[model samples]
Target: MDSNNLDRELVGVLFPGIVKNEDKAITCLGGIRNISQVYSNPSKRRLGLSFQPENPFVRKIYGNSKKGAGVLLKVKVKKVKEGNEIKREVVSTTVVGCVKTMFRFESMCDFQYLAVHREGPSDGPVSCCLEKILPSGVEVIDFMLQPSPLLLIPSSFTRFEKPIGYAYTDKRHPDRSSPEPGDSVHSKTRMLRSSQVSPYTFNLTNELPSEPHEVYVKQKEIKFDLHPRLIEEYDVVKKLFDERPIWSLNLIRYHTKIRLVSLKVIMPCLALYMKTGPWRSTWVKYGYDPRKDPAARKYQTLDFRLRHAAGVRSMIMSREDITTDRERKPKRSAAEAAAVSDEIAEGSVYFRRGMTPTQRHIFYQYCDIQLPEVEEILAPEPPPGYLCHQKRGWLPANTGEICRDHMFRYIKDTLFNSNNTDLKFEGSGNGSSSNSDDGGSDGSDGGGGMSDEGGFGSDGGGGASD
Candidate 1:
């Protein structure tokens, strides 16, 4: 509370953990304790000391001193037993001034307070005092107290390898039938032999008989002289070379339309055409416009429109439903639509028409389905009275009768055509009647021939052979 005390430097003591002698002491930042006030009288030229007791003497020293002042004291540290543990306690002894008289002041005073000031604590009790006091100018300096050497309490000793009461056996052991020490065995008679033995020894000794040299026979080497002929002369070889162009041509014809459907199909076809030449032309030819065909065109356009609408709808409905009924439903977006379209274009869709039974079989093969089951399910029953003609490969002699028979039989027997109640022969009341000009007669005699084509010579052949 005193303004003079405010100008005075404050100082406090610290007990550092560890410090080398050359290291500068760092200021201790902590609460003050063990506050002591010192007053000097000019009459006696004597100093008086008064202190407030605190748990660590340094805390009180720090509290009583001015802001910055040189505090000198000899600290006595002792580790005294408290309860079951020994904890350190520090006691501070401050020297106010040199002793003017030897009269006793208090019962707490000890001979350690009589020691002269030294830079640090000495081994024995030494006398010390504060002198040369100033009113306002005071420099604060702290002596870092050294802590007592750490005494390590002994720990209970433990043995790392302790004896166990029971003996342990290994779980992994060979079976009883496995080879053991001192077992008599023949190498050749063993069921299994070591791979180290030579395999050739078994073949030489076990299988063969030794024989003496036979009578001498002269060996002759026969050689035939061959003259090379041009490969073009062999019809088969020449045909192979010549057919390459035809194959390439057929490929071009068959694959031109197929290429429009998929590049995967197109690329292999192109490679085959390039390798085989013109032979693929007939197969690859696009005779009819796929889009112009009425039935196929309508179906394709409807399919395309439906796919596009579905894709648009999917793009619009992009949110995934979280409810249980719709949790597993796929999220629809542009990318998903594109993926679905790609799958559809890659896979085959069997349209209702334009496919023969053989073509359907091939399609099933393309789809990797078994064909035998399909054949069994769709097998047709033999027509009445046609059983005898079927084995001989002969139809009725009349052309009209044959056509009439096939149309009626196919309509009656086929599952697809059986329900067509309006089925009838076109342009004929009697389906068995022939409408040809010769009335079903074979035209060998030329009954309606134009006059001998201006009369050729009838004797023997008169035309020039050349």
Candidate 2:
């Protein structure tokens, strides 16, 4: 019954050591009220008489065979008490396992091993035993599953120091009041060969504040000649932003033939990368507001799926038997597939699919993952973006969604949090607004926050303003 995992009224049990087949499967095991003698009576049956079943007792129960089996139950007390009085010495029977039926007409019971308890105990590490599991952590099953590519989400979204998933994404705009501490890889990158580009140049704000392409593309003429190629690339980036308020790395590099190394320096000044919502991983201009621009609305939000396929299968075998991937990915050769076919026929119940959100709310009430309550009335859009952690590298199930998610988030954050234009507006209105304000004077709202170094927002704008 466990092998098939179905429900039925009757089944057959094949006990080990017995040589009987289907024909000889039927046997009368005497119980407290035997029905055999009553059916054997030669007299006519009485009209008013009723026959109710009693507790079944079958001896010589072949315990080993799995084909036809009955449910086994163990009662610890194993005795019936009389009216507040003892009857005789009590001998309790220990039921080994629970059984289910293969079919309705089954004469022999089809049984599978199931440990039925009033309440499930907490899980822990233990050993195995062929006999009953006398204590914790012991199991009849052999070796456990090893994760080949276990995947999780929290680690990917980790912060460097301060407890913020949001962090320094762009060097252009640094947070003012939050200590404005910034992380830099320059110390290490500067050590690299001159030809190599830095994985990071400098960024103090996460998801660089967004702005209008008109305002975002404005460039400052800095005299620094440390890298002459950077000036050439910066000019080209400004031109591209003129076409659109947002641009991803590939879109910029592929079309303009810009060196990625140059982009590492240029991008932080031009735009902020979103980590969640709508424009997930894309880089939006510093002054472009997608929220107000109907044309940009389409790029602000997107929808997709997130699936967990890494550790779905739970079949355990010897380390040697695990020749290929633990999850059996990559399509093993026919022989290898066939060899493990019969072995891993049964799937684990732990990963039951098609479960409703309501079901999960109940199942995972105490778990780290929980489904938030749904609202019949839609709430206004606010932009947003456990356990048993075995130490192993876990590959995400699908990457397309990851890219989409990042792009969406980039757009959303750029649209909502970015108000670069306000700084420009304030500067221009005061008339003391420096020349740097010209970069964002294109009549577009852009972000220009208080700069940590000197002028407006970032050093790039500071030099222009000065």
Candidate 3:
């Protein structure tokens, strides 16, 4: 292929490399220093290409200048014959290396290897060899090849220090305050060079505090003695809340007993997804246990529908090797079969779609189900009273809602017994012990009164004196 054809074929690749030292920065393509070096080449017989900022080739080939990020140059090499005859020709270049800037932070300079390809088909044989000269203190860490090109979002949407799964919050807004003091600020990015882009950038706070005073939620102290493992699990969940985007789906296999506690903490953001269909079809699809163990074979079968995020759709068959139809016993009579079919038709539960708010409330309560905003394993509980769905009795004629503190105290009272007697300290003297001390006891002297441990003591003496 010719040079024109090569220019027509455009290809872009991203490579991640490590800098030799943490303190030094990598020099990127089209940098002032690179231009200076190219110009300062000693040999006068040189053929070269420069992808300057305004160069059409830079925009067409690199796709993103990134302030002169991706550029390729091919330089010629000179070969001198015995009697001062010199031969020079352009050399083909591949695998260009440069320092990649970490967003706006130039201080974080790391080496990046970019594979540049122009629209082309060429197999040129350049007999003249270009001397291999590598920059000092530069090393290739790892090479990742991706078929898809990298998708770019505005830098404002993904600032350098912002949390990975959270959207950028503007601190300049007068109505909002900074995150609470205890909220963690640490975050790190994953798949820095992955070509894939997530469709959504989750807002860190779906419901912002209404006022400055409400910005900081008073940390509730867990007064009860809890298992260390439970405490650690709670911390892990809070850390997840800080790290993972709230809307992202997560699968959790949990200890059955602890599942309720986890749901209580994160139910505000959880949404359960349920799929329902004909029992016979679903059972046939998922399969039944054909094992001959009477206990295992006696289990009831129910239909379950699974939704796949990916587009692939096929019925999954069970792994049991036994032939289900052949091993199964035939029904005794047609009358009995008809009776059973009628019973099944009457007893089968039907999940009605698109229920009214009141109907949904009743349905959820009856089914013991609560679907949150994101699907997660959660214990079904009645919705919080503050979020009532009933249209008629929302505000009763003579009813008052309980205060939050009162509810908390009631829960504490129910779960805890008053051990005040053990906590109480009694004095030996009746005067101090029986009556409240208002800076004086009725029968004690005005000065230093009787010491509780020392028994009856006079104002200036150990025993009663004149």
Candidate 4:
């Protein structure tokens, strides 16, 4: 290797397909590339004029020195007969793409190169004296690379799709072990085949490995106490409303440790639930009016379409697995949900994927199997000013709705009754507080609820009402 040659660009030709005599390989490339028997690639599909004595492309390539360009040609083979000898002849040639022999100087290790013709005697044949082989850089082609559109590659994040497994709700022998008496009868034989190491030895009554001690891992003792009378719960719930205006059923059950059956009886006496607007699907304090209070901004709802940032894993469930998950849950009451107890509890372990610096060093010292990392996948944080707790614009409320007559035959004006707003005026903050001892729909005050004071993003007093 010459030191001066290291700084120089190597001349190379970027060919797409192998130069092979096989007809099938030529058909795959659509007759654009030449054949190996004719071009004679010495090694690694390399192109050098030094190899063959009868290659016809050498003259065509070297003849275009001043052009300073490499070319991809479409050539077809046809039989040519001269007397008794018949030879394969290239009858067609079309220029597909021309490669420019130019290079960008900055941060570019890749470039195209064209071989130049060496100066020689006028009567002598031209030759190129250079390295044995120069590696080529690849560039995309204009033609369709794939003829079929059925094949595709999915994202790596989608490792566990519907193809993995369906929902399995079997309660007994979750590991599929033979725990039944029928399974034991099936294993019966005239000769004793049971070994000490056999999995059949595993049973519910199997003794512990260490000393016999009390085991309580699977089932926790959840004792449901007798529910207090609804009249007595009214005062406790009113105090709860004073603490927080909005609460979900799960939070209601989790905080007070009350069963769902009692919650149903007590909830109607105090808080109200809405099907729409900011407090949709959750309990809202009955008498709190959004009109005069700054606290209304805390529960205000905003509508914005969410999409994962580019190149990030999607938070949306893959549709393929939705069917299995949907079948697991049927519509159930709040009490039934409380019994299932899917609420998040305190002191759960949330871990990162990669090992700590000390752990990494310790694990790198050996090549034994170890437990896999346990990183949790958390959702990306919302943009600033997007959360419900954030300060809102001069917008009256998150949303407000009109209460009109339910008659379909004629149009009617909205009904406004603000009298109930004074009923639970001592709820939380200002003259208005959240939580329900006596339930009322939104803006139950004298004039109209928050809906009369405009909503979301509009001038106050009947702005943005729907």
Candidate 5:
């Protein structure tokens, strides 16, 4: 048969070990009943087995060879309880396994191993051994069995009007529409069409409106009643201004979070005082500027007012004078030079004064000068155009023991002296003596009353005159 076209069912049998009397057979059958109940449980619904006895007593069944023939026993299985009680019936089939040819009179009997199948057409065999002998001499045995194998049968189950058993035509209904192969009755047709009547038809266009569409709505205007106190307060405030005042009562109510009457009365009085004080100018500058159009100036005035009020309140409540308590300690005198010398002797080479010329120069450049030396070094030099009448090469001596401050002052003085001498020479000398005709102006007053020979005089003479 074709493997694709097969129908199979699952069946089973139970073999009781041995029975010496009729009552023993009944007891042996009771064991099968217990196994059936176990199989009927929902969890064990798939479990199924079948056993067939080959002999009534001890009979040997032939195998491939007579020497290796196995024993077979006549086994009968009766349905104690159907397995479908708890679940759907499972499709399964069963077959036989090995058996012992000899009847052993031992405390326990053993049977051969059995094989189980998962998807084949046959259920493999199971083996059993007598474990306990009942009081009636019946053998109570337990066997290990495999789950039954089921061959799923395929049938031509379809929703066709007629079976495909044979191909034929009905002569009585010759005009009937024959369905094409694989045509389904639920099929539908779809159509697509263009809105234009003809393929070459052109669309007509319309001109758009020149003006934008405007929508007008009639909204009901609501009027609220002003409290008597609020009205009086508004009147008082309005009296301050010649024109009718436009006060926002909502703003007053929002700021105070109080009744309109209370806010209106209190706000105006507060505004009156605020407008008279130093805050008056600030208020006008920030909030009450009538020069500005209302719509153009949004919440600028209100924001300024809020900030100003907050600042004023903060300033009034804040402490302007604050005093702090700090501990004072006596000033300590500078350590003696001898102590410093001793420390230097014990410190690193860098700290000690035993440095090379280069090291000493670097150290001196890095050190701070004393106040007296700093003053001398930074003192302003004599003005340019001043004569230095001292000996030309009279160089100042450098004292080896000179402090850093004094050394700096000496360098500054030397630079200043050199600069003054250069200025004096340049001021006294003219470029040439050929221009004697233009001497009166250029050589005398032109030179600012200073002579070419490094002297000050009204005339162009090399002499000093007061």
Candidate 6:
């Protein structure tokens, strides 16, 4: 193309493959006769139109020919039938160019090409020129064009929607109007629908490859089972057992050591029957024990007093317990409580004298004698036959030494001897010999007289040595 041609606005329609008949192809495209077929392979017949401000015709058609403009085309086809032949011809044509065409072109083509047209050419085809199949300036191509990976199209032709024969009625493309309702592009547009981007082309950097990364794994022992806390710790044990020779050796060594020490430690415990013995605690419980040590006796008394003091203090300070219990009894006003306290103080010998600081503090804090009587919380006496150092107030003191003496006697009988005639070996032998003499007198001889004489000579020699 020359400088003049470049300066002027130019529009090119690309018919993808070879055109077998230029006249037939031009005729098919130049009028409405091929509108249905044109819509069928819409992307194959792509259009690239230029909008240059220098072109006076373009400037007149589109108000601002400087930046952007729109174009609309309308064509009428007439079909005449003579005898058995039907002829189709382009009779009338109208093409409107305005700013609205730019917006319509962007929407229909994903901003990759101008508005798709199917019905007619922009003006009447009055001029014809011959040009090379491949133009010179198109030599440097950045990337190869292919259909979307998601959508698989075979060799057969498929119909795609294309908006045709537009009129310059509005500057904005109508969003409600769609040729194929469900055929909207699922992929991103060539240019973002933002004004900041170049609407004519796409940015290559944004389409970089995003392959997934491999995760790192730690090489550690494999555990077969999940623990209580779901942690894997004993994995090596299974592996060790799998090694036959190693596991056999380990088992032999462990069992031999266990057997060697087993009898020495276990026999005495079994003989003593310690496993079946009752357990005893060393901790102490208190009542009033005269036999207890002075320190222990003092400790028990102090503990009892402190517990009593705490119960009194709790009754004074706790609002819930005091308020609930007061409602159950006859209600007494503050004035009546004061009068009773004064009367108690005046009449009682203990309160008539001058009070110590502690006694005076207790009297005022616990409402003096106006306080209700508390139930006696007595401790239960320990059972009889219990062996302890403590003494109950009314029950007998523990005579644990008697139990100890009985245990010693039982041990002596088990270790040494028990008096029983049936258990004596010699006594049973003597009784059996005496009973046998009385029971039987007849005797039988099995050896000869010579054999008996030989035995008598051997017995005489044994008696001589003794």
TM-score of each: 0.12, 0.24, 0.15, 0.24, 0.11, 0.10
Q: After superposition, how far is residue 79 of candidate 3 from its true place, in Å?
A: 4.7
Off by over 4 Å in 3: 6-8, 13-76, 79-466
Alpha-carbon shift of residue 459 in model 1 (angstroms): 35
In angstroms, give how far residue 387 of model 1 lies from its true place: 37
lDDT of 6 by residue, 1-466 (tens): 1122223342323443367966654443434444344334343432222232222121111011123443444568999999999999988765533232121123122122212223346564433111222233654443235221222224332132344675868624344233355565753234224222111111212321122111100111111132222121122232332332111111222333223122222211111111000101011111212222222211111000001111122212221233531123566998776454333222111111222111111111011112111000111233443332212111122111111122222322332243332332332222112211111011111111112221211221221110
- Candidate 6 achieves a global lDDT of 0.25
For every model shown, the clashing-pair count is 46, 60, 10, 9, 13, 2
Superposed Cα deviation of residue 167, candidate 4 (Å): 37
Worst 10 residues of 4 by lDDT: 359-368
Model 1 agreement with the true structure over 50-137: per-residue lDDT tens digits: 2312112211111111233343334577888989999987765544323222211222221122113444456755433222221235
- lDDT by residue (1-466, candidate 3, tens digit) is 1233233322222322344632222223344464345334412211122223323222211112122244344455656566767666545544333323212222222222222332333664333111122223453543123233333323332123222455678543433334457865642223223112111111222332222121111111231133345455555545554342221111121212234334333322222111111011111101121121122211111121211111101122222334542243555797666444333110122222221111100111111111221011111222233221111011111110111112122222322233222322223321212222111111111112222222111121211110
Q: Least accurate stretch of 10 residues (summed lDDT) in model 5?
A: 215-224
> Each model's RMSD to truth, in Å?
42.8, 27.0, 30.1, 28.2, 45.2, 46.9
Q: State in Å the error of residue 391, model 3.
A: 18
Q: How close is candidate 1 to the true structure, as a TM-score?
A: 0.12
Q: In model 5, which regions exceed 4 Å deviation?
A: 1-226, 243-466
Worst 10 residues of 2 by lDDT: 386-395
Query: Candidate 2 on 1-466: residue-level lDDT in tens?
Result: 1333233333333322254543223222223133234233313211111111121111122122123457554444445679997656435555455454321211223222322222234464333222233324654444343322222223222222123355857543332122223744432221333312222122223333444233324432242256676787787898888877766564565466665546755776777655333344456777775444434432332222111112111111222444422133366897776445323111110112222121100111001111121110011222222111011001111211222223223222332245232322222322122222121111111112112112211221121121
C-alpha-based local distance difference test score of model 4: 0.32
lDDT of each: 0.24, 0.33, 0.25, 0.32, 0.26, 0.25
Model 5 over residues 1-466: C-alpha lDDT tens digits? 1232123322223233544565444343334574456335423222222122322222221111011234232344444455655444434433343332222212222232223233433474433221211123442433224333332323332333223466576644343334556877643222214211111111113221222112100110111143344555444444533232222333233333345434323333323211111111111211333322322111111101001111111221221234332223355455553333223211111111221111112111111222343223223232344332211001011111122223323333343355344422222122221122221111111212222233322122111111
Model 2 residue 62 CA deviation (Å) reads 44
Tens-digit lDDT string for candidate 4 (41-134): 3222322221232222222111111123555456788998999999998777655555444221111111222232435566675454222122
